[model samples]
Target: MRARFVSATPSEPAPPPRDGRQSAAALLVARGTRRLLRRLDFASVTELPLLSGRRADIVALSAGAELLIVEVKSSVADYRADHKWRDYRAHCDQLYFAVPASMPLDIMPQDAGLIVADAYGAAILREAPRHKVAPATRRAVVTRFAQAAAHRLHALSDPDAAGAEAF
Candidate 1:
């Protein structure tokens, strides 16, 4: 499914609750991964689109052909609740997990990469999405990244953004 953002004055009408913690976590992973990727000379973006039926949290592209998807979890419950994260297999070339700063460094999938991070900082302890990711999916990632990047860049350029600096 596709998701869009909407904004309205609170006095006009309270729209809907966008309690997209799942989507938020996905974006967090993307944010954290982008930080990690930059160290490796890569550009990263969050909320990469999917091919009709799938969605990815974070999408990162190295200067090389490298690509990655990161899934961030705020709680253990969140992690256990998602057992089929493997299904993301069809979409990303790499699968990774981003955990809260307080989470233990262990217990993550040994084969899969791990990124310890919070809202501000991220460290790449490991890098493993899956063994393989489709080429088309990689393109979808790039397209989504481009779109998200443009939106953020535009917002940052706006004078009304108020102290918001580009990351």
Candidate 2:
């Protein structure tokens, strides 16, 4: 599923009430990461798409212009079922996995950084090694972020946006 921005705004409606353990966990991870990244002064958009057709759970752009992609895993099954995360590296300067505190962190790949998160906030457990993205790819991702953010903002102000086609 595409990563969606969580907000109380009518344009970007919040996710439905949690119905299961996995959904609850995902909400927590996404909320926590949103808090964590903002605290670090990075502007982020959730559910941003990559050129490869995969959606990043969260895409953050730092003040220094570094791109960061976070993959949120709510359960062991969530992690195990996903192997496409590697594809995200090409679109980001750093890639990290966000999970709840109860998860077995040891199972996470040693190469990727880790974050321990709850509904209110998150802390980085490990810093992912930075591999600077190519200049062209960085430009594309940044442009996409800008467009998505703009689209969302426009939707927020447009009462008819609900029925409008996505850009």
Candidate 3:
């Protein structure tokens, strides 16, 4: 069966807090992280599906074509319960965990980068170590990113038309 994709757009009303999936706090961290990425000259898409069948919390593309994935951890329990964040490393050049300031910094892995964020903004506390992606993988990732962005934009511009297509 084909999958149906529904992403938020400026014209649509905000989904209920958490949208029955993400917690409000986690969503806030993602919001601030996206802002921070924009400031850093990176364009990002939230909840992007990776080739490995794992969905990333945020996938950002730098001007130099570097890919970074940010996993949002709202609380200690949230971080501990998740084991799939490590799998994200294969899909991007760098991996990071973004949390609110209230989260203790030390609990996060020392290897990946870190960011502390809130609803308004965010700060990168540590830079992630880069593991360059293969050229073929980079091309595939960039293509996916562009396609996702374009699909969302099309949905916003013409909801009926976009919905009619097989996504």
Candidate 4:
């Protein structure tokens, strides 16, 4: 399923599960990472679809218009099983791996940024190297991100509205 960003509020119902396959630890990391990103003045969405048919665990847009893609790895096996993260580099200005504190830091690739997170918050252990995305690709990704965020907000406001499931 495609990803949609949902805002949480006191009166609103909780958002649906992002992905049933995600481990509890991974969810904690994602939550903390999102909080950290917001603190850094970046707007982020989870499970955003990419042009390459891959779903990014988190996509953040900075105030300066830089895009970042973060892949959450809950375990060593999870990281080893997935090699698609390499493709994400082409879609963002920076690529990072977010993991729980229990995960071994050395197992992650040194080229990408590293983030250690828990349920409360996260810390960026290493900064990701800048990689300029093509103007065309940047335009497309930003468009998709905007559309998804808008759709999710609309859905939350009017759940019964037509095309709510489009995102």
Q: Please state the error at residue 53 of candidate 4 in Å.
A: 0.9
Evaluate model 2: give its TM-score.
0.84
Clashing pairs counted in every model: 3, 1, 0, 0
CA lDDT of each candidate?
A: 0.63, 0.85, 0.87, 0.90
Better model by lDDT: candidate 2 vs candidate 4: 4
TM-score of each model, in listed order: 0.65, 0.84, 0.86, 0.89
lDDT of 2 by residue, 51-114 (tens): 8899888899988889999999998999999899999999998999999998999999988889
| Model 4 lDDT, residue 79, Cα | 98
User: Superposing all C-alpha atoms, what RMSD in Å does each candidate have to the true structure?
Assistant: 9.5, 6.7, 5.8, 5.3
Q: Please, what are the lDDT tens digits per residue for candidate 4 over residues 55-138?
A: 999999987779999999999999999999999999999999999999999889999999999988999999999999988999
In candidate 2, where is summed lDDT lowest over 10 consecutive residues?
13-22
Model 1, runs deviating above 4 Å = 1-33, 129-132, 155-167
As for candidate 1, its clashing pairs are: 94-129, 95-129, 113-128
lDDT of 3 by residue, 67-164 (tens): 99999999999999998999998889999999999999999999999999998899999999999988988898899999877876676546688352
Which one wins by TM-score: 1 or 3?
3
TM-score of 4: 0.89
